[model samples]
Target: MDIHYRNEPPQFDGANLQMHFIAEVDGEPLDCAITAEALEDHFGAQSALEGPLREAFQRGQTLIRAVCTRAIEQGAGPVVLHSGRFRSPDVPDVLH
Candidate 1:
């Protein structure tokens, strides 16, 4: 239920944006997610304004990984992490 930021002042440019989350249970890494965001805001929002969103994503990933890892680590079974793009169900078909 705790989150940690491995990097501060995360790069805004698509080239340097790297985000990672480590899920740990009983102090052991179980699952993790690594992702990068390449889009930019046109509203000229300050960097500080984006921290919460980035952090939240990272934290959520971490927690998910932790839960999955914990289950496997405790001899429940293996853990698999899947990665893919997400789209809103309401989006127009043209975008697909």
Candidate 2:
């Protein structure tokens, strides 16, 4: 199983960042929120990531990976975030 997402530009909030995103698994909508703080816990010091959107999208990818990991750990079967031509399932590669 794989998941794909389309994320909006992140909304910054003090020490946190939130990305509004939409995802689909088996082609069904799965609305989710990707936050920088959460990513920091999982990834650490995202503020050092250089650009704003770049960091935001990176957090989005971390969110996707976390979800997949949780599913797999629960014996939910193999899952991955489909990749195509360097495309990001959670957020756009370029800054918006």
Candidate 3:
């Protein structure tokens, strides 16, 4: 899985921050977008959602939470986060 911050030079004018998360498993790709504020709520303002991301990383699930957390801390302002699963061949049947 790869986490990247989109919209070069994240804006911090109180606007929503956008992040892109890409997950690949067995050559299949899963992409998702999420925001900063949502990340802040989930992982606090000083830390990333590494736990959730790790969970996804281990379970082969498409995770965007960590990417969003970084985007927000990098200056992406208050954000409205959104996420979903994409095409993934190695995703486990049940996510722990």
TM-score: which candidate is best?
2
- TM-score of each predicted structure versus truth: 0.27, 0.39, 0.30
Q: Give one digit per residue, the lDDT tens place, for model 3 in 34-67.
A: 4444344432333334444333323331234444
lDDT of 2 by residue, 1-96 (tens): 556555554334344354435555666655444454444443443562336534645645654545644544455443323322123343333411
Residue pairs clashing, model 3: none
Runs of candidate 1 with Cα error greater than 4 angstroms are 1-16, 37-96
Task: List per-prediction Cα lDDT, in the order shown.
Answer: 0.36, 0.45, 0.37
List the candidates ranked by TM-score, beginning with the highest. 2, 3, 1
For model 1 the TM-score comes to: 0.27
lDDT of 1 by residue, 1-96 (tens): 432334333333234343334444455554343233211121122342346436544444434344444444456433332222223343234324
Report, for all candidates in order, the number of backbone clashes.
0, 0, 0
Worst 10 residues of 3 by lDDT: 7-16
Off by over 4 Å in 2: 7-17, 45-56, 59-63, 66-96
In terms of lDDT, which candidate is strongest? 2
Better of 2 and 3 by TM-score: 2
Task: Superpose all Cα atoms of candidate 2 onto the true structure and report the RMSD in Å to 1 decimal.
Answer: 9.7
Candidate 3 segments exceeding 4 Å error: 1-16, 46-96
